[model samples]
Target: MRWIEAWTKIQTLFIPGVAGLREVVQGTRTTHPSDQLQCPQDFPLLLPSLILHSVSYDRTLEEIKWKLHEGQAHNALNELCQVLQSRAYMLKFKDSFL
Candidate 1:
């Protein structure tokens, strides 16, 4: 199968408490206004909800593409690498002062 479809299937597997999550081939389920899902504060639920949320489907791939375009345009990958590199230093500084 195509990579995007494979990726989507893989992502569905990581969603917690969801059984048999499949791509909507026909249409979406109708939901009442008051029956909508509320975002939970717990990390386990929150992370999956954030990852699987409909808004992410539009922007995540674009964001990844932008981050991967290192030298062609803005070096977001370099900026991310710098942030990652500084993480340990920041933690050490915090531990020393706080």
Candidate 2:
């Protein structure tokens, strides 16, 4: 499926810097770092939350609170993921049953 492939590509894009990603996030604004992902199926804000959830250390909770206050992406992203999955499943059943 195209969506799976796309998600795979997105996962690959993230695979490179896991070791140094925290430093990169903390060190400098050389790049958004998160921009390298291809996440059409993902909530735009979900991407950052996903990253935060993944590599966040003890301070990540505080950081997440900050991001939540500053950005509306977290809630929006969760909703978007549910919507996309529901729609995708609907399409699948529609194609298969009808």
Candidate 3:
């Protein structure tokens, strides 16, 4: 199997409820070993929503590729620098429009 495919099969343990866990295909399911996952710092937020959010089969691999190559969240934080700066200015000046 390919490296990515092999990596994909392994699930992570997430204690959902009292003694009731599920083996979900994605988004942090219960795994026998912890080493199976190599998650980033934002893993806590990403894991819960990986499967909950949808990407077409054709695009899933592409999205994964971008995730691996890009810094984080499709580089959303970087992309929104202007917006963040504007918000920061407004908040500093107590602008009501903000």
Per-model TM values vs. the true structure? 0.24, 0.30, 0.22
How do the residues 1-98 of candidate 3 rate in per-residue lDDT, one tens digit apiece? 34444333333223122112222333354345664546543222323235444322234545776677787765787779978998888898886654
Q: How would you encode candidate 2's per-residue C-alpha lDDT over 1-98 as one tens digit per residue?
A: 47655754664455433336534543453357775445544323224456655653455556767887767777788889999999999999999999
Off by over 4 Å in 3: 1-74, 95-98
Which candidate order results from sorting by TM-score in descending order? 2, 1, 3
In model 3, the clashing pairs are 12-29
By summed lDDT, the worst window of 10 consecutive residues in model 2 runs over 40-49
The models' CA-based lDDT, in order, is 0.48, 0.58, 0.46
Where is model 2 more than 4 Å wrong at Cα? 1-65
What is the lDDT, from 0 to 100, of the residue 28 in candidate 1? Answer: 36
Preferred candidate (TM-score higher): 1 or 2: 2
* TM-score of model number 3: 0.22
lDDT of 3 at 89: 89
Measured with C-alpha atoms, the lDDT of residue 37 in candidate 3 is 48
Over 4 Å off, model 1: 1-74
Worst 10 residues of 3 by lDDT: 12-21
Question: 1-98 in candidate 1: lDDT tens per residue?
Answer: 35544555565554422323332321133146653334332112223444455323444555665676655455676788889889988999999998
